[model samples]
Target: MKRILPQPLMSLCLWLGWLLLAQSLAPGDLLLGAVLALALPLWTVRFWTEPARIRRPHLLLPYLAVLLWDITLANLIVARLILGPVRCLRPAFIRVPLDLDSDLAIVVLAHTLSLTPGTVSIHLSPDRRVLLIHALDVEDQADLVARIKQRYEQPLKEIFAC
Candidate 1:
């Protein structure tokens, strides 16, 4: 069963999604959806890496709250910066050194930075030791790097244990 259905949940979701999009219960549609659901997961399973193990699952809620709060605050700050004089904008690209060794943790950090307004993650070093970010207004690059490390990276390191 495992060999035949490597990701049964994914397959089920795909089938349901297909039906939902098609909005049909026809036999042909059902057959097609089933075929797609099974085939897609089978084809993609080889590309899937090992799943990330959360070391501190309880911290997830707190992490999410912090992320949401930061997003809200960043939205207001970015709005102000955008509305203000163009000359006041100090856009800069800074490389944040990573203490995270896990690929999952690094990806999460990159996504978190991108999700927050005014900041965009540009590139990750080949060795995965650093992440390059572009910020809309950078008063102090060191401060921003430290804030990210403290607020986001450190928590992620603790949570993911990487």
Candidate 2:
């Protein structure tokens, strides 16, 4: 079973996602979804170096809520900065030190930063100890770094348990 379904949850999600996107209950669609659900994971499983293990699954919901709220607030702040004055913008590149050792955790942190408005993850150091971020407007670099560490990184560390 493990050999056949390397990632059972991922397979299920892909199958459901395919059915939802196709919007059909036809036998052909069902078969195709099943095939894709099975085949894709098999093909890509080698690329996954570490099996994703969520230590605190219960915290996922609250983490997502915080992420959504932050994104919304960031969107408003970015809009104001863009509409107000380019001269007032204090664009800067921030280096955020990582406490996460897991590759999956680091990737998630990077993606979350990129998803938020006004910030984009530019690079991850060769040792993966630091993540470089480009922000559209930064009033205090230290504050931004602290916020990112506390708001995003800490939650992820707990969830991924890295």
Candidate 3:
């Protein structure tokens, strides 16, 4: 069952991605898309790992929404700093110790942080718990840490752990 459906779904997404990149939906392209929808995953089996199985499907959209909004806001803030005649950039590297220990939670946290405009996930400790983040504008490291904990890590714990 896993092999059957996951393969097809993967193929379908690959097909859709190709279509999107091409920006056309003509009849010949449709045929090629159908071929890709059946062939790509079969050809790429050894390269693919089993995807991370998200436990809470209900949290999916809300998580996406949170990420989208954060990305937009972060982009605007970063743009303002960059476009200003005098850039008031207070760049700082902060070591944020994380309490959410689950590997999935950590993955989400790292990805979320990197996705935001001005923040980059510089490094994760060997133990995979502590994250070293670089913020483009770090007014107060404490406030940034608090925001990361409250806005992302807390909800990640609830969604993935609790």
Assess every candidate by TM-score: 0.75, 0.86, 0.74
lDDT of 3 by residue, 1-162 (tens): 656545754576678887997789998887898787777666676765545445565876787798899999999988888887796689999988889767767877999999999998999999877899999988899999999998888878777763
TM-score of 2: 0.86
> What are the Cα lDDT values of the candidates?
0.92, 0.92, 0.81
Best candidate (score: lDDT): 2
For candidate 2, list the clashing residue pairs, or say none. none
Model 1 C-alpha lDDT per residue in residues 25-122, reported as the tens digit of each score: 99999999999999998888787675456789799889999999999999999887778666667899999999998888899999999999999999
Assess candidate 2 and give its lDDT.
Answer: 0.92
Report the CA-based lDDT of candidate 1 relative to the real structure.
0.92
